[model samples]
Target: MVGGAILRKLEKRQAGGEDLTLVTRTSTELDLTDQTAVRSFMQSERPDQVILAAAKVGGIHANNSYPA
Candidate 1:
């Protein structure tokens, strides 16, 4: 999320109006834990760059429940 915000800021600095492609995905569309799907998406999209925002996020109760 932080990186995406930073990217947006950087893009605004450019004078030329460049096409912006935001590859935002909901958790339901792609699971970060699934490496294969991620790799495939990367290959197909072929984005010149990438901003990694997805994380293994959890709540306090969930973290306490699975202390791994």
Candidate 2:
């Protein structure tokens, strides 16, 4: 919900000619917990800024499997 709101705001700004690019990826496409994957992605994209709104949402089993 928070990420969606931020994304909407960014989209509005972009539409209003903010001169910025929004880069996004789904969890399936990019795993935030993987250091190597993140490093490779950052090197390839070289984005000026980043909005880290990623979260891991799941129930008991998932929570047990992946503890933070």
Candidate 3:
């Protein structure tokens, strides 16, 4: 959700004439657990910036259920 907000901000900035390449992915598209693909994409794309938005959830139950 927070990443979505930031992406919106980037879109607005790009719409204002800035050059930006917005690369986003859900769990289905790019699972962080796959280190090989992640490394390959990172090396190939070479983005100017990176955002690691994965963080702790609200409670222990949420974390325990989705042990990524």
Candidate 4:
């Protein structure tokens, strides 16, 4: 939900002629837990900025069973 909101705001900025590029990927496309993959992606993209809005979501029961 939060990620969606941030993306929308960025999209609005881009539409308003902010002179920025927005690059995004789904969890299936890029797993944040893999250090090697992340490094490779960063090296290839070399983005001027990054926004990490990804997260692992769970319910109350799951949280209780496995706390992080």
Q: Pick the candidate with the highest TM-score.
A: 4
Please list the Cα RMSD from the true structure of every candidate, rounded to 1 decimal place: 4.4, 3.8, 3.9, 1.9
What do the candidate models score in CA lDDT, each in turn?
0.73, 0.91, 0.83, 0.91
The digit string of per-residue lDDT tens for model 4 on 1-68 reads: 78999999999999999998898889899989999999999999999989898876687898898898
Residue range 1-68, candidate 2, lDDT tens digits:
67889999999999999997999988899999999999999999999989898776787899899998
lDDT of 1 by residue, 1-68 (tens): 56667767767854357677656676799777799998988888888877676656578888899878
Off by over 4 Å in 1: 1-18, 56-68
In candidate 4, what residue range of length 10 has the lowest lDDT sum? 53-62
TM-score of each: 0.53, 0.78, 0.72, 0.81
40 in model 1: Cα distance from truth in Å?
0.8
Candidates sorted on lDDT, descending: 2, 4, 3, 1
**Candidate 2: count of backbone clashes, pairs at least 3 residues apart or interchain:** 0
Q: Could you tell me the TM-score of candidate 3?
A: 0.72
Candidate 2 regions with alpha-carbon error over 4 angstroms: 57-68
Across 1-68, the per-residue lDDT of candidate 3 in tens digits comes to 67777888999999999988888878778878899989988988888899878655667788788878
Candidate 4 has which clashing residue pairs, if any?
none
